[model samples]
Target chain A: MKNKTNTKKGLVKAAFMSFIVVLFLTTTNCSSDGTQIVANFTEIVMQDEFNTEGAPNNALWTYDVGTGDNGWGNNELQYYTDRTENVKVENGYLLITANEEEYNGSSYTSSRLLTNGLFDQQYGRFEARIRLPYGQGMWPAFWLLGENCDEVIWPQCGEIDIMEYRGQEPTKVHGSVHGPGYSGGEAITKTYTLENDRFDTGFHVFGIEWTPDYINYYVDDKLYNQITPADVTGEWVFNQPFYIIINLAVGGSFVGSPNAETVFPQTMLIDYVRVYKN
Target chain B: MKNSKNLYLKKISVVMAILLTTVISCERELSEDAVFAEFGSNAEIYTDAPVGLTDQFFTSFDPNQGANTQGFGTDNNEAYLGSSSIRIDVPQPNDPDGGFIGGIFLDRGQGRNLTGYDALTFWAKGSTTAIIEAGFGTDFSEDKFVVGTKNVVLSTDWRKIIIPIPDESKLIQEKGMFLFSAGTQSTGGVGYTFWMDELKFEKLGTIAQPRPSIFNGEDVVQTAFLGAPVPVTGLTETFNLGSGVNQTVNVAPSYFTFKSSDTNIALVSERGVVTIVGIGSAVITASINGVPAEGSLTVNSGGNFDLAPTPTRDPGTVISIYSDHYTNVPVDFYNGFWEPFQTTESADFIANGDNILGYTNFNFVGNQFANPTVDATVKSNLHLNMYIPDNIPANLDFLISVVDFGADGVDGGTDDLRQQIFFNSSDFVADEWSTLEIPLTLANRSHIGLIIYENVNGSPLTDFYLDNIYFYE
Candidate 1:
């Protein structure tokens, strides 16, 4: 009987030890935070210098069937495609090129990248260093949208435009935010110029820091705009997880339809992306 | 018994420790959120007012005036040189392309400047209808220009329209005006009877007008501007020597004549700064190289002033509101107006209020005016309305105002101008309907309203049409 009691006590002690071991392992691997260190997950998933033929690997993005007949609400000419000419990673950078072609019903072709199912985050910093195209009618953008966008409409789901530009103004880049109350023409935006050559010549950094309180946009390290809680009056669509999107759209509403002056094969180059947390 | 009790206690203690660790770790993880920053540089805002044609401050609309020449209208029949030197017209068969043609030029001089003063106002009126159009160009070839331009719809009864060029810094300023190519090029379109009058350029007055170039001599004027050299600094240094750098480039030799190389006496750098290289003094043509660009420079011995002085005209004043708050607001008749209405789902009425324009010069009291409402989002057949008061006169003059106020009072305000228009009411309506079609270039996605004040003689009437006013950047 005494022996039986001893065995029972020993079993209980063994169970307790196992539980403690598992708890310690979890704490060490995850730090004090609940997020486990994703071995290969880095802030930047892709970068292209346009120095080579194709864009970086794993840059597989999706197309949005725009709000209207045009590709999205922009009424842009270029249709997003998976072809190497539309997008490629080479020469140490990623390139989204707009070429004159017939695809879907549009006369122009380009590539759009999105981390939709590949990578997404609830709240984090995202940025892309890119070089813009020149001339009239060309448009380039790096932005973010809510992950569950299929269920929700645009602007209503919220959009964080880290960078946008037109070929007419080859030297300047704009950062903005759009939502239900302040979408489209009323979007909050600020412009920044390039430090080196024109945007078409070399790559420049375009980034955004989105949080519950505010959103900060930058060109290189220069902070051009900040969107506070007060800036948003509609649904707090930004609170949910969002994925990254990179695209080069042909002429649409803001830049107007591409005219004859606009040259084909306009390219946008993207460099590395890095993210840090406190 | 005591040992068993102790064992149970140990088990409980371990469990509690594990739970505590798990909770703390989760809290820590929350702090490590991801955020990102953008990259780029800032361009300096050039607010300095330009003075001479030799100044590197203008970009020409057409560099190579080829076959069709840089004119207005569409591809098939453009408005080229007409019998009268001042007019460019659209050949009949009026399609979208072959309409009117106009151009502006910039002359690269001492400074790397191409844009113009902030405010640009001109006096223009149509001989026939109130429909006139305008666009900016960079090259003479139809392929290199910004086409599909719409007019501001000026009055046929002799009125003045003023427009403040947007982001002058973004303009190819070397030498350009806000170019207008009026009259419809659409098929079955009635030819244009409009004539643009007195176009003038003025410098925006600030603390001190940046000092003008000190001298104007046959010899290249030596200058030391305050800022660093620009992208295209010197016309002589940048151009190919084989292309006539050793000859004189006429500034304002004549309006429509293509400049020719005489003695290789003139040279300019890509920076736009010019230098007289040889002896003979020929007119050094200065030109702005982008849409609505213009430039004139003449250099000769004995310091002869061959430079054609810019025409003088009235400063830019406001025009009448096209349409806003469609209900109970008066739309101008003499000036002519077009406001389409639409029905859509998002157009439901809310308690807060509708969009209204509010600039420093204008304001509104909350609830003082009843909220104007719009319909929901829809595809086709949706529309809004604007009413032109039947009380309009045969001849008229006025300014328009509009605003769209958003919730935070940040961008909501009046004075949202889409384009600059020039017209007269008499040409459109001798005694009957004053029909005019004007285009709103930057109307989408903006939060603002309109205000129309009649300076000559008029009163507010409540009728207008509107539709499909959405927001976009």
Candidate 2:
């Protein structure tokens, strides 16, 4: 996905403070120029707090099962299963558990959940709060795929990876977009790295504020990267609706195969997923 | 159910609180102009053309010709800068004649002097992804001299397109027409509708060069099998006039002369096709009026150059879905079983022994393996042998999919399942047959229905082949 380094800590602290001030003003329904902030709270178009027990809400999620060639195009080693042992909800969170066990001729087992047909949206604020799993060869992602993927196929259908983390670099996450001229390793990507903490230590918010002409990525409300039409080399295909996907992969192209240091039964805990539109 | 009701009440209360706050703030009035200014200050301006030169092409414009297989009219519902845009509804296979399926013909009765203008700019949007060919054509007939044809991909949102015009001399005809032709649909069905607005010519400050820079393929090592045609199109580039305010004009490849550095290694045709003569390396170059673009081609011998093998499996009792064994059957097996759709069809390269289906440019072949239903659950894997001639360029990929129609029997319904597989030339050995074995367990193969072969990343006009497709336990 993204290939970024680290941001200066001093600048991040200053930006964070400014963000807090803006959030407070906007919530209070006031603008600095003495005018009312219209639509202070964007309408919630879709949400899943994962407060229920047992299975995830069926109305908002579906499952992609089986093992694909080269790990679903990336040469991944995990076999995706719909069973609760691999994917489930508990303690106000959705858990995607990856286990070091053989099943269906694969060396590992994991989960891939999607909102392919149940819920798809065009442009809005898409965000998720997640606690990542750590280890070499672990790959976790929250991404979007165009709804017409079946008809137009990928790259042509467009892809937007809001957040992707490779376990080898536990402190950084990436965001990227893939289309006709730019796809696979050639996609437009940017990395966001934490200053002094690893992503697995706690939960962090990753999001994308998408508009007609721009897509701005954020980590815990701090803007990291922005992509515009000028950044694209081929047809700009993000104008159509896209579906959400959350997957935890094991031993794939991005992070390489798991080694002795890798642990078993790793989990990616997701607190919530929310979409807001104005 | 009780918890859901409680959650609903809590959400409603929060919304009510926000509404109450908004109502209270409404008492402090902001001027209507002030509110508009807040949102409109940074709006993008599309053009600065006076009302006379910018023809919105509302219904008032007369003498518009051509028929759409679906329909066409003035749509007041949407526009780029004005109150309306001309909409053309295109259906599958829209070509009524060799020209555009449908278009609005603007009569330039006596050509207005556009001496200072560098290009034509307009706003367009499509119901689906659409590639439209637009340019200035004289005579409106086969003998018309097209100033320049530019392909533009339109999205659902309105976007501006600038077509640079480098050769003004081609616009000498006193009577000319602005035309647009829709590209053939890659996918089947009802097709899509597109809208155009704010058509005008403008001077964008700098003038374009008379000819554009030649861009041959990137310099790299290439491999071609002994008996296969060398990948030549990758070594050739299309002529496109450079875009932007100041740019150069590109002459078509038809005017360019091509040659190979070593005739003993490879022979370059006038059309830029390089045939591998023997094992070695050669530099291929295309020159137009002395400007040249060069690329390297290497031929490697020793690969399976044999023709496609005859199917060893029996078709009668083995539940064969598609195979060349039935090619000569009298019932026309392809009538309802399989069909191919493509933008352009030419037989320049063969993918396999003389019996497989081949395509050029954006193409898709759909096969209805089982009309009502087929119990493929017993089949563990779906197998297909594909032959991508050396002529297909690198970095370009293709896709194969096995579709399960679910209970609804429709392609894209909610319950339908699709197993899409993507591959490139790197996935196979050059000049040899590659058999792809895809596991059919998770695709709900019990009710397997359709199979589709599509070209995704291949260069336009690159040829590919497919044969011996079936499923087995």
**How high is the lDDT of residue B71 in model 2?**
50
lDDT of 1 at B5: 68
Compute the lDDT of residue B306 as modeled in candidate 2.
56
Candidate 2 chain A has its poorest 10 consecutive residues by lDDT at A1-10
* Candidates, DockQ: 0.01, 0.01
What DockQ does candidate 2 score? 0.01
- Model 1 lDDT tens row, A78-170: 777767887777777777788887876778888787778876776666767777766578888888888888788778888888888877766
lDDT of 2 by residue, B1-473 (tens): 69976875786678666666666689875443331111001111122222321263211212223334345565766666545676776655535532235443544233444444556668899998767666553334442334444457788998876666544434443233355666454335446788877776665432222233333344544454344554344322232222112222233334356677777777766544656666666766665445565444444433335556666655543445656564421212222322233443432343244445444333665667445656677777777776665554666567878888787766666988888888876777655677887877555666667777767755342455566677766
Writing each residue's lDDT as its tens digit, candidate 2 over A1-278 gives 01111234556788999999988866664343543312222789999999999999999999989987667999899999989999999999999999988898998999999999999999888999999977778899999999999899789999999999987677789999999999999999999977645677689999988888788888995777878889988888999999999999998788899887575788999999999987
CA error at residue B323 for candidate 1, angstroms: 74
What candidate 2 gets wrong by more than 4 Å, as runs, is A1-278, B1-71, B74-133, B136-162, B165-206, B210-217, B225-256, B262-279, B294-304, B317-325, B328-348, B351-381, B386-401, B418-431, B436-466, B471-473
